[model samples]
Target: MTRKLLLVLLFLMAVEMNAQKGESNFSLGFNYGFGSEFSNRNYMFTNQFYKVQLYYRLKETKHFQYQILVQPEINFAEHQLLNFYFVKPDTPNYQQKRDEFTRLKDIREYVLNCGFLVRKPIGKTCSFYVLGSIGPMITDTETERMSKGFAFADVLAVGFAASYDKFKFDIRPSVRHVSNAGLGSSNAGYNTKNIEFGISCQL
Candidate 1:
């Protein structure tokens, strides 16, 4: 947890440093998403999360801009039992395995994301954007049967943005995918589909 806290502090500090240089292209943002999780069996599990984002972008043209985002998220709720990996009932160890793995329902996650954003202005202060990101993530709760404690993650999102003076806000719908990327033999990976509503202020 200490490393995570340090990362958060460093992220904020970078933004602060940039602001002191008279850069007005930085924005601080917060996002919340509601979505369903789907597993290998084609099931949807209930989950929700909150994200805090820091964004920096440069206007490349009258209608185009480039953006970068550093975001951290805290996930809440838990997956339903129907999505768990379970041993066959016929196996002698089935009951024991089930009991052991069931506790993961209270799992919480820490995710750090960095992304590149592409924007096209609709008109003046309103714009449309698409983004792609890669990052690292860890979960506090999971079956130890899995080898690794962390995995690589990906994010893809599309959103609409509106700028009003020095304040801006947007709504983004996105998908997040996490995979161990061969670090573990069991890389089932996880996916979440959700929408994020965000508000930000220019520095």
Candidate 2:
């Protein structure tokens, strides 16, 4: 199901590319993030993701530009349950479950993000932007906080970009949240703070 959804998005992007008269760009990015201490579970989480982004400018003015973004990424993560007491003493097989959930675990996630961007030019070669996106994700491992399989990832970010000739460099700091939106039994999502670096070219 995720593969089919990705294919459909790609097809739609291709069609939109051919139809649109505005500027477009393609970018590659690397992100590193660590979990924030806001959840009920006592766990430590960190992640790294490689991203591919497509941006299509919808409107441009002297001061601001609006664009649509489609991003697909491969994510690698590490999680460790810090406090065994989080499992509770009364649960069945509590000791075994605590041992299982406390061990350091590696996780993988595939994500597709669709979003919008608003940019304000600061100089001839520099701009600042705000972006918001939400998308479907697939997790390859289950842990105490969230179940394996389908979920949703949402992001909000602000960034700076510098342009030189045909190339652009970007640095963005973002907040991310992932959950199944109650589709699964476990819904204690992960929240993280992230920083990303990217380079792109007009296409």
- Compared with the true structure, all predictions reach lDDT values of 0.72, 0.82
Please give the lDDT score at residue 183 for candidate 1. 80
Encode model 1's per-residue lDDT on 20-71: one tens digit a residue. Answer: 8665667788888877675455233556788877787755787678988887
lDDT of 1: 0.72
Tell me the tens digit of each residue's lDDT in model 2 across 1-203. Answer: 54676587567667766876875443333343434434545998888888777676788887899988878888889988888887788867889989998999999999998899999999799999999999999999988788899999999999999999878888888999999999886788899888888887765
lDDT for residue 142 in candidate 2, whole number 0-100: 84
Clashing pairs in 2: none
In model 1, which regions exceed 4 Å deviation? 1-23, 39-44, 83-94, 102-104, 143-148
